[model samples]
Target: MALTTDRPITTAGLAAQRQPERNRNVGRTLRRLPGYAAVALLLVVVTYPLIWLFLGSFKTQDEFLNNPTTSLPDSFTNFANYSQAWSSVATYLQNSLLTVLPSLALIIAFGTAAGFALEVLVWKGRQTTLMLFLAGIMIPGQMILLPLFTVYFQLHLTGTLWPLIITYTATGLPLTVFMMATYFRAIPKSVFEAATMDGASIIRSFISIGFPMMRNSVLTIALVQFFFLWNDLLIALTFTTDDAQRTVQVGLLNFTGQFGVVEYGPTFAAICINVLLILAIYIFLNQRVMRGLAAGAVKG
Candidate 1:
């Protein structure tokens, strides 16, 4: 049998005990109220634009002209704008894929190899070489644009996708190398050493061990480079002379003419499509990218 020395509590005593807890709870809620309000405001800030864009895509040019901001679409089922936009952007979409995909592959391939060699392999001057590569990151793209354009014009590569591909690959590689090198540095050198002792070649060791371990980091770099390439208008417009070679961003210009005439509905539709594509990609890979960034932060 269990015995307890206890005092019977009066109603007033229980109320006294609960009063402090209630006050403390109210105080905590009051303290947190501003944070909740800020989050709600941020949600509205981000969400309202997307909702507006979606609604605007369904509206007619007249509807937008009369009341662009306050008016809702007359019909949600209207899809004429999408058809018009798609017809114009189909080739542009293809061109973007062709250019961005190849550059992405080249960036990853060279970056990973450079990172592995720099961090995993024992060598003199590796740090100096890495510094040289990192220096590229600080150089602004605008500084090289005119020189690159002149060279591309001489080479007859201005109208082709080669300029875009080469530009993206070269520019993206330095940062990729930096990120990948940091990741590779965090890994144990002994792993590569053991692989070496087991008769594995450096390439084999990188392939079998290094690449697999840094998959998440690779994805992060790919996503970043993809976004940069996909949304680029300045470079695409400067290099691409032909309509067939234009990117999606450039293709969106088709809906506007020189006389101040703009096809607002179709333009909004195209913008929506472009944004949704990138948004879908981000949503799919967001978790992995977050994990990679978190791992890098912890390792650093």
Candidate 2:
């Protein structure tokens, strides 16, 4: 036998063997380039209008009219459009705040309690109650608009923010309760049992344990409800005839018409302001909202 030598493969040898596989993966990724390019192009198509609107908000009417497609303004520091927009809708923004804040508070409180009770507590007709709440989601808002208007008119609430608050809270309930209940159901039963063993009442347990655990869900509900209430032009227009009682959505429309000629810069500025407010809230609470949605989808 020729001097037989046994040699073990080193890590380098293994890596060399794997390099072909890595190269193949890289080639596959490259082959999917068209798909990625399509997705990128779709995103640009969808977002271009929003980008244009934002940039247009900064331009003077003459500049915008002259070069409507221009991406940048001559002066980025000019804020007259923003000032004019804010001044026009200041009261409507206040009205929206007044309507949305109290309504959100009530929705959270009631929805949390209702969900916790239905999911965690042992009771008769709980399923039926849940079904009833779920049924509200199926009812088209337009179908109820006439009846709601008539009711509000009878109660002399059509001209005030109270009707808007009540309607928003009521309409928001089905989804809020559904989301909250689904999230609450996902909590382990042992947690509640442990709280009970510690001499905690349902109320105390919910306050101490459930609330913290479901914080993300609550944020999600708040975010959804905020958007719903904020962008509600139809309901605001239907209920609020007075300019003083109008929400920002209605105010923006009225603002556009006030001059008998549309000032694109100021109008776009107002739209941008509204969009920014919602966008800011989304950026802040987005992570929590996603967590809440994921938790809700876990079991129900």
Best by TM-score: 1
Show pairs that collide, candidate 1. Answer: none
- Quality of model 1 by C-alpha lDDT: 0.89
Q: Give the worst 10-residue stretch by lDDT in candidate 2.
A: 62-71
> For model 2, how does the per-residue alpha-carbon lDDT over 1-300 read when each residue is reduced to its tens digit?
698687898999999999999999999999999999999999999899889888888898788768747558877777999999888777888999999899999999999999999999999999999999999999988898899999988998877888889998998899889888898989998999999998999899999999999988898888898898889888888888897888999988877645587888889899999888888989988888888778778855
Using lDDT as the measure, the top candidate is: 1
- Model 2 alpha-carbon miss at residue 279, Å: 1.2
Q: Which ten residues in a row have the lowest lDDT in candidate 1?
A: 291-300
Per-model TM against the reference: 0.94, 0.88
Candidate 2 matches the true fold with a TM-score of 0.88
Work out candidate 1's RMSD over C-alphas.
2.3
- List, residue by residue over 1-300, the lDDT tens digit for candidate 1: 989999899999999999999999999999999999999999999999999999999998889889757689999998999998888877789999999999999999999899888888879999999999999999998898899999999998877899999998999899989988888878888898899999999889989999999999889888988998898888888888888888898888766745878989888998999989999999999999998886577464
Candidate 2 local Cα displacement, residue 27, angstroms? 2.6
